[model samples]
Target: MGAAVTPHVVDSHHHVWDLSVRDQEWITGEALAPIRRDFSLTDLLPEARAAGVTATVLVQTVTVAEETPEFLALAADSDLVAGVVGWTDLTRPDAADALARLRQLPGGQHLVGIRHQVQGEPDPQWLLRPDVRRGLAAVGAAGLAYDLVVLPHQLPACVKAAQDHPELTFVLDHVGKPPVASGAIEPWATAVRMLAGLPNTVCKLSGLVTEAAPKTWTVDGLRPYADTVLEAFGPDRLMFGSDWPVCTLVAPYGEVLDVARQLTGSLSDGERAALFAGTATRVYGLRLSEGS
Candidate 1:
């Protein structure tokens, strides 16, 4: 008898942080208190293994340059983390040089992309800045993807940036963070569809549980937003992500994966496989061996 092939699930988006090393300033307010402490790769492995996730892409939580190298080092040491989407100052004139330097670091080979906290920037068009544009060019030239962690309002600029840099693949994290709590989909859906219209764009099926109405959110509540992206980007252009400790605010890790499965229940086996693994592998250029 032949051996059965294990399902290969890839968590395309998630984060890890040490609170003692640096505070996650964004983790303010009573609601976010649950996740104020440290979260590490060690903390994630068991749950990830239980969820049948063979590999994962650890993403940046802060804009600190030091954090990228740290994440790369972690990737180098870990078997499960195949890639890292770290942060680098896109406004720096030496952005390309910085990327080159990062690639030379111990685990730099695992760096698959760069991301900026566009949602936190006051300027909605921050991505369109000349300096940022130059950095984006450098990233494209480096042959790395750029992850867009933006709010709904910033998606227009996201579209422009994608249009301006057709060479780089722009990954839209968390479905542009739709207004799930309010059940509003107009502007977000319209903007997301526009971004999906670009050939160089991809979307992550993540963070919706946190974006919904606290603990009361249901699979049905997330369906509209999920359906919009599935129809817009299609399963091949979309990837699954747990969003991790942040998602813990609303549901546990297992529940998060279950909800994503339920939301994507209507897809064909191949389509679901693409959403859960293939898309992330192709987009991130993840180095996953059969043993992985």
Candidate 2:
């Protein structure tokens, strides 16, 4: 809709949160307080529209047990949110029971996946522990996914999580939160390659600019990592995401998508379509049935 260069777009990652409801410990005093206010589907739709993104997957902002049902309710009434990645008590013994409960929510049909705040843990092996493995297995059995939200230093844990649970689909967030502004690439790229080697894995091209210094990030600043994801996962396993509201710290939604479009100019059209929209529809089961 924005231009003829691309068709429809399905953003695979973004978050909606209200400080009145809960606090995001990750956003502290000085850096990103501007986003502390509630960012719901209303605040997000305009930004996504400017970027030519039709629908998005609402990601869980907190690890609290109540938040998943909250997101499911929001997605159930909203059209812009095509799906959701909620959270569950991965280490709890009742994880399988918890997954069943999640399915009973009104918006559970939009619950394509689940996530835990693994980045908060100091131990990189947290995902591989026996109890956590059980939780991931429950997700795979329920036909849901687990998303990895970790720092680059924690990528080995992501690798372990993917390698150990070959049945669970793993979607890496923010290109492993790489240090793009500093131009640091080594172990990050190498780890990405290792994770991409897994057959059940996919990666989201989201939340990159926030990792770089705000406003100063150029398309080139994001290219190496973007190119790395595309090269490592190929088009079929990669999906685009705006990571909105949090991305407001870097640039507006339209400019961020411009960075993505420019950075991805080298890929063929079919590959671009997959990253922009096709992969999301397939992975999240967004293909609708016959007409109403």
Best candidate, lDDT-wise? 1
Write model 2 residue lDDT over 177-225, tens digit each, in one string.
Answer: 9988788988899999999999999999888888987758777778789
Q: Which ten residues in a row have the lowest lDDT in candidate 1?
A: 1-10
lDDT of 1 by residue, 75-173 (tens): 999989999999889898999999999999999999999999999999999999999999999999999999999999999999999999999999999
| Candidate 2, lDDT over the whole model | 0.84
- The all-Cα superposition gives candidate 1 an RMSD in Å to the true structure of 3.1
Q: In model 1, how large is the Cα lDDT of residue 240?
A: 94
TM-score of 1: 0.97
Error of 1 at 44 (Å): 0.5
Off-target runs (Cα >4 Å) in candidate 2 are 1-4, 287-292
Candidate with best TM-score:
1
* Candidate 2 to truth, TM: 0.95
